[model samples]
Target: MKIENIRPGDIEAESFRIIGELLGDRKLDPRYEHIIKRCIHTSADFDYADSLYFSEGAEERIARGIREGAVIVTDTKMAQAGINKTRIGKYGGQVLCYIGDSDVAEEAKSRGLTRSYVSMEKASRLGRPVIFAIGNAPTALMAICDLAEAGQLDPVAVIGVPVGFVNVEASKERLIRSGIPCIVARGRKGGSNIAACIVNAIQYSL
Candidate 1:
């Protein structure tokens, strides 16, 4: 992918294509295809409108899951904070949270909130594939895939929604490494907004 030409919206399209390819041989219900199409169109709709090119409140939704003890993993403080706020706003308390930071992990543990540091190794051991956002944490994402390959983490799915232009391929690489079929945004166009949209689609699909 051309880093210079990459945009967040482009990644959203790529993710849809990848998911379609992954489901090629599966007994995918029409509903599943509808969900993907709706999501893709929704994203494109926003992009075409020239207003609100990203999904709002994604961090909050992720945080809600984390608060519910969903073994979440993310690579950005903004995402982490957004997730936390979502949990707090919806659940009115701290969620069983873990973060990529050592200090945050320790803090969560100190509070006895079922906290642990997020690492690929740890995420893999959690017995579930996690939705990974694109960020600067390629190493961590790769580690998560390694663990999945080693059977440490049996992730249900993977996603490549890298925000901004840096390392868009990292999320895709993680999805490939995890070997858990997933939906991802393509190229350097992915960002936090696109990643969150994909997650929303997954949640709605389920």
Candidate 2:
């Protein structure tokens, strides 16, 4: 086995120093900066800092939900797997994915709805405060917003960052106006990894 004397903690510390240097005179509210840095770090894309949209106090709301043991639901299995589940577990959060599940498939087929919408419907029924970490399927993001507005699903926070030209921009825009605490990536640049990165940043902070 290859064993190193240095602990894993050193890497993040060093990376932070480098990131800080590269960031230069540009500044964000310190409280929200780490989330941007983490996203960029995860994808090596500097555009995330400008792309991320946050509601007032969204970070605090999300952290509180995490500490309160919110059920974290993802629209895709890739997103579910990409989250730092170990870190989420530290705060009593559990990740959930209903996509590709037999029940979800059956319901989607029955209703002629996308599995993403079915997953959001299921998330609503968890009865616990939900932190939706969606990275694919703009349909899920749009559905969650509609459900929230219609007095159906009441998610504590939504991380909506699906990538593509189709409905990607529109869904995120809807989340901004959905009246829920949201951290969204606007425009056509997002994916499962970026979505998971945002979740991990909040978990790491608290």
Candidate 3:
């Protein structure tokens, strides 16, 4: 098979064009089109078109929060690294991943908890608007839900898409019912890349 010669700058645009063609006649909510397309682009999986779920007004809330300089916290460094820090910075926003922080590690170890869980606890104390983009750990989603239930946290929005077999769907379900603005990938299909792409798609749409 011969590779098609294409200009570097046109590759992404071309890819989206193809995705649109393949999805012909499938109407997408205008608010979520870019996010769904970005998810498919990142993973080359069309399943995202059907699996992604958005709570009412989630996009608007997230956009407003970002404009207000909400801190974006991710479960994994890979997710954090994939986010467009420069673009978010233009709005005075920043991306952070605390899973690898030394203090988080120590606390998790002492408490016999996953570092991802500890990270959410740490984030809850920020005292400012926050957006959680959790893609690799269901426990992180659980921790956030727990915090919310206890009246200790009120995040601007949550992107819950952790991929796994154990407790993944349940955690996402909990987040969905928590009454927080969120974007979730139903079932057991998601990743750090998907999480970051979703965040980037939101930023791009703004």
Clash statistics: count for each candidate: 15, 0, 0
TM-score of each: 0.47, 0.92, 0.98
Query: Which 10-residue window of candidate 1 scores lowest in summed lDDT?
Result: 46-55
Alpha-carbon local distance difference test for all models: 0.46, 0.87, 0.94
Better of 2 and 3 by lDDT: 3
Q: Model 1: residues >4 Å from true position, as ranges? A: 1-70, 80-97, 103-118, 127-136, 164-166, 170-174
Best candidate, lDDT? 3
lDDT of 1 by residue, 87-133 (tens): 33343333122355575577556755322224444445555425454
Answer with 2 or 3, whichever has the higher TM-score: 3
At residue 100, candidate 3 shows an lDDT of 88
Of candidates 3 and 1, the better by lDDT: 3
lDDT of 3 by residue, 56-142 (tens): 999888888887789999999999999998878999999988998999999999999999999999999999899999999999999
- Candidate 2: Cα lDDT at 104: 87
Q: What are the RMSD figures for all models against the true structure?
A: 11.8, 3.2, 0.9
